[model samples]
Structure formats: structure tokens, C-alpha cells
Target: MKIAIVGTGQVAAALGKGWAARGHMVTFASREPGTERVQQLLADAGPNASAARVADAVGRSSIIVLAVPFTAVRERLEMAGDVGGKVLIDCTNPIAPGLRPMFDATTPGGATSGVEQIAVWAPRARLVKAFNTTGAENMAAPRYNGQPSTMFICGDDEVAKGATAQLAEELGFEVVDAGGLSAARHLENLALLWIHLARVNGMGRDIAFRLLRR
Candidate 1:
């Protein structure tokens, strides 16, 4: 399947490289028109991988992964044009600085849970929430450890979820069906727990979420 990654950052580059390793045709998109950074990043993605403007990238791909900073997500979507009728995967967790996940204390609602909010901007698009946790370094250099890193996904569309599951599996993660878009609230909150542990407890960047079944 054709995949378009809507960012040129570490997370986007890592996922794009992983997808290319899985033999999927992938493109990395950026807001800047003449981006040498994305061009250099695409070099790691191989010949099948290239960079394009966000709208053009979204228009050509079957799936779109938004891996930009959470703070920039809303405007990024707005600038990416109306991305309707596409499987838009939201990997953003609106984390601010010095605070918790959203980076702001006393925000009331869950922190870093901006996936659904972004989905509202693209009402006609099939939005799937995924890949918000874990540092980009871990994703790029996954240890595997004889177990799959749990990747929780939530969406209103089952078909879109299934497609995301396949992508997650290909990306070397064990997919967990976290139910509908409502589940995004918890996952977004989970980002805080992870951040707290990674930052306060010194758990390390290689740490990822997983569910233990008894």
C-alpha cells in the first residue's frame, strides 16, 4: 500500500524508513517547499521513498501518518488541505514543556490527546490514533526483545483500524485494538505516564508500552 508520512522529523523519518523496509511505497511530506532535511531523510528511505509537499503527498497515498509536533498539528492539518476520504493516522500527543504530557498543568482534560480534535478538522477523513508514545530513537532502533512493543490504536472505522494494525505489525509492533476514538483520551493520558516515567523515573527512551495478559 502507498503510505505518506506528513512530517520530516525523527518520528516521521523512522516510520518512513520502517515502512520502506517492509517494501511499502512511502513518501515523506513537509511544510517547507525546498526541504533539504526531508531530502536527506529520504535518502535513508531508499529510492522508493521521496519527499513532497504535504497535500501532494496525501493526494497520492492510501494512508497518511501525521508525525509532527502536537502543538503544530492543527495548523499542519489545515495547511495540508482538506484530507477527506483518506486513512489519516494521528500520532500526535500535545505535549508541552515543564508540565505533563500536554505540557500544561491544570488543563482539566487529558494531556496530549489531540488526535480526535485533529480528526474533527478532517471530518470526512478516516482517522486512526497511533504511534504517539515511545521516543523516535526506540522506533528506529527497536530491540524487539522477543516480544512486540504494544501499539494501541483507536478509530471509528474498523477497516482503517485493520489497515493500521497491519502497518503496526509490519513496523515491528504488536497491535492492540484499543476500541473507538473515545479510547484516544486514555492513550493520550498514557503519554503523560510514559513521559513521567521516562523523565522523572529515568526509565530510558527504549521503554515502550505493553499489556500483560494473564
Candidate 2:
């Protein structure tokens, strides 16, 4: 799969490296594609990975991962150009300065969730809420105690969700289908709890959410 990942941050690097290692053609979309930082990222991602301008990367890939900050969602989407008919995986949480959830305040359309706001920003794109409830370290190596950590994903488009699920699985995650995109409300809130536990409460970044069934 040709995956375009926007942003050069930890989450983007983790997902890009994981997918690249899995033999997927990973293109990191960046504002400074020619910078040394992006060059290092490409080197770290291996031969299957490359860097390009946001529009160029998005134009060439079928799957686009928005790994940028919550405040830069609209700007990044706009930079990607026409993303219609593409699977857009949203890996961001609407977090305020104090690590507080601020969906309504952050989103322009009064969206209840960050994914919903992303859908509003790029309405034509097939949006899936995923990779938001865990740290980037978990994304890089999801296994804990020899078991894969759960990755919760939700989207209105089943096909898009399936594609996103496959990517999550490729990263060693146990995917859980969390219903329609509206369910992102709970998922985003779940992200808050994760941040609280991992950062605020000093539970450490190694912790991850899991689901057990008999």
C-alpha cells in the first residue's frame, strides 16, 4: 500500500517506519521535505520510505495518515489538496494546553470529536478515527507481555475502516472495530484517559489499552 503520512513528529515517524518495514511504500509529507530532519526520518524508515511535499505525497497515495497536531489539522488537510476517495486515518487528539480535551473549542464546526471535525475539514475523504488512544512508542512497538495492544478504530465507511484496521494490524495491534465515526467521541475521550494515566499520573508511556474476551 502507498501510505502518505503528514507531519514529521513522533507518531508520523513511528507509523511510517512500521509500515515501511512491512514493505509498504511510505511517503512522509512534510513542509520541509528537503531538511536534514526529514532526511534522517527517511533513513530511519528504510528503503521503502521517502519524503515529499504534502500535495505530491497525498496525490500519489491511496492511504493518507494525518499524524499532525490537533491545531494543524485543517491547515495540513488544505495542504494535501483534493483527498476525495482516499482513506484518511486521523491520529490526533484535540488536546488543550493542560492536556484537557477540547473538541468543541478546537474544531470549527462545533464537532463533538476530533475525527468529526476532520471529516468536516475534508468531507469528501473517507475519514477513520484511529491510532489516537495510545502513545507513539506503542505505535512503534505495540506488543506488551507477548500480547498485541488493542487499536480502536471507527469510521462510517466500512472499507476505509478495514484498510485502516489492516494497517493497525501490520503494526502489531489487535484491532477493535468501534462502530461508526460518531463513536469517535468515546475514543477521543479514551485518549484523554490514556494521556492522564501515562503523563499526568506517571504511569509511564509503556502502558497501553487492551480488551480481553473469553
Candidate 3:
């Protein structure tokens, strides 16, 4: 699969490297594609990875990963142009200053989850909410004591969710289909909890969430 990751941050870097290692063509979408940072990122991601302008990358890939900061989501999506039938994986958390959850209470009908708002912004894209409830370190290596970490993903489109699940599995996560896109409300809150546990509670970034069943 070809993936266009729309960010140059830690989470983007981790996912890009993981997918590239799995033999997927990975293109990192960046504002500064020619920068040393981006060049180094491509080198770190191995031979299967490259960097390009956001629109160029999005235009060439079937899967587009929105790994930018929550504040930059709309801007990046606008840069991606018309994403009509492409699979769009959202890996961002609406985190405000002091680690507070930034839910929008005035979004037309009612309060909206970050991913739900994203759906409104890029309505044509096949959207899936994922990679938000864990740290970038976990994305890089999603194993804990020989067990794959849990990855909870939700989306209205089953095919999009399936694609997102496959990408998560490629990163060593045990994926749980958490119903439709509305379930992103819970998943985003879950991401806030993960952030609190890792940052505020002093548990550290090495910790990850898991779902065990019989």
C-alpha cells in the first residue's frame, strides 16, 4: 500500500518508518520537503520512503494519514485538495494547553469529537479514527511483554476501517473495531486518558493500553 503521512512529527515519523519497513511506499507530506529534517526522516524510513509537498504526496497515495496537530488539521486537509475516495486515517488528538481535551461544543448540531469534525471538513474522504489512543513510541514498537498493544479504531466505512486496521496490525497492534465514526467520541477521550497517564501521572511514554479477552 502507498501511504501519504501529512506531518513530520514523531507520530508521523514512527508510522512512516514502520510502514516503509513493511515494504509499503511511504511518502511524508511536508511543508518543507527539501529541509534537512525531512531528508533525514526519509533516510531513517529506509529505501521505501520519500518526502514531497503535501498536495503532491496526497495526490500519489491511496491512503492518507493525517498525523498533524489538531490545530493544523483543516489547513492540511485543504492542502490535500479533494480526497474523494481515498482512505483518510486520523491520528490526532484535540489536546489543548495543560493537556486538556479540546472538544468543540458549538459545532452546528451539537458537540463534536475531533474526528467527527474532521469528517465535516473532508466529507468526501473515507475517514477512519485511529492511532490517537497511544504514544508514538508505541506506534514504533507496539509490543509489551510479548503482547501486541491494543489499537482501537472506528469509522463509518468498513473498507476504510479495514485498511486502517491492516496498517495498525503492520505496526504490531491488536486492532479492535470500535463501531462507527461516532464512536470516535470515546476514542478521543481514551486518547486524552492515555496522554494524562503518560505525561501527567508520571507513568511515562513506555506505557501502552491493552484489551485482553477470553
Candidate 4:
């Protein structure tokens, strides 16, 4: 599968490396593809990976991962033209200044989640919310104590969610279908909880959530 990761952040690096390792062609989209950081990420991602302009990367891939900062979302989407009919994986948190949840404040009436806002921006693309609940460290290795950690995913499109779940499973995670796109509200809160635990509680990035059933 051809994948476009639209960020230089840790989530993009981790997932890009994972997919590239699995033999998928991974291209990281950057405004400055010639920079040392982008070049280093390309090198680290191995032979199957490369870097390209944001629009070019999104144009060439079937799966698009929006891994940019919350503030950069609209700008990145504008650069990624005509994403209709493509599977768009959202791995961002709407974190504002002072490390607060920005979605609630910005979204009118609090009726939609961040991922849903992405859907509004890219009306034709199939958007799925995943890879936001945990840090990139756990994303690189979604296993703890010999058990696969849980990754919560939600989307209105069943096929898109299935593909996202498969990708998460490929990265060694037990995927939990958290229902429709509205569930992203809870998922983002879950991510905020993780950030709080890692930053405030000092539980560190090694911690992850898992589901146990009898």
C-alpha cells in the first residue's frame, strides 16, 4: 500500500517506519522536503520510504495520514488537494497553548470532534480516528508485558475503519472499534488523559491501555 504521512513528528516517524518495514511504500509530506530532518526521517524509514511535497505525497498515495499539529491542520489540508475517495487517517490532537484541549473551545456548540472537523475540511475523504490515544513510543512498539496494547479507532465509514484497524494490528495492537466518528470526542479525551499521565503524573511514555475480556 502507498501511504502518505503529512508530518515530521514522532507519530509520523513511528508509523512510517512500521509500514515501511512491512514493505509498504511510505512517503512523508513536508513543506521543506530538503531539510535535514526530513532527509533523516527518509533515511530512517529505509529504502521503501521517501519525502515529497505535501500535495505530491497525498496525490501519490491511497492512504493519507494527517499527522501534523492541530494548528496546522487546515493549512496541510489545503496543500493536500482533492483527497476524495481516499482513506485519511487522523493522528493529531487538538492541543492548544498551555497544553489544553482546543477542540472544545474552537468547535461551535461542541457538536463535533476534531476528526469530524477534518471531515468537514476534506469533505470527500474517508476519515478515521486512530493513533491519538498513546504516545509515539508506544506506537512504535504497541506491546507491553508480552501483550498487544489496545488502539481505539472510530469512523463513519466501515471500510475505512477496517483498513485503519488492520494497519494498527500490523503495528502489534489490539484494535477496539469505538463506533462512529462521534466517538472521537471520547478518544481525544483518552489522549488527553494519556498526556496528563505521561507529563503530569510521570507515568512516562511506556504506559498504554489494554482491553481484557473473559
Minimal lDDT window, size 10, model 3: 103-112
lDDT of each: 0.80, 0.93, 0.92, 0.91
Q: Compared with the true structure, what per-residue lDDT tens digits does model 3 show for residues 76-133?
A: 9988898999999999998777776677566565547888888889888999999999
For residues 22-98, could you state the per-residue lDDT of candidate 4 as single tens digits? 99999999889999998999889999999999999999999999899877989999988899999999998987667
Candidate 2 accuracy as TM-score: 0.96
Q: Model 1, stretches more than 4 Å misplaced? A: 101-112, 141-143
The numbered model that scores best in lDDT is 2
CA RMSD for every model?
A: 2.6, 1.6, 1.3, 1.5
Task: In model 4, state the lDDT of residue 86.
Answer: 99
> Candidate 1, residues 1-214: lDDT per residue as tens digits?
8998988888898888988888898988887737677677777789789788887888889899999877777777777776788899988787666645553334455332577667657888898998876678766765567777788889899999999999888777888899998788788778778878888898877688878799
Q: Can you tell me which runs of candidate 2 are displaced by over 4 Å?
A: 104-110
Q: Sort the predicted structures by lDDT, highest score first.
A: 2, 3, 4, 1
- The regions of model 4 sitting more than 4 angstroms off are 97-99, 109-111
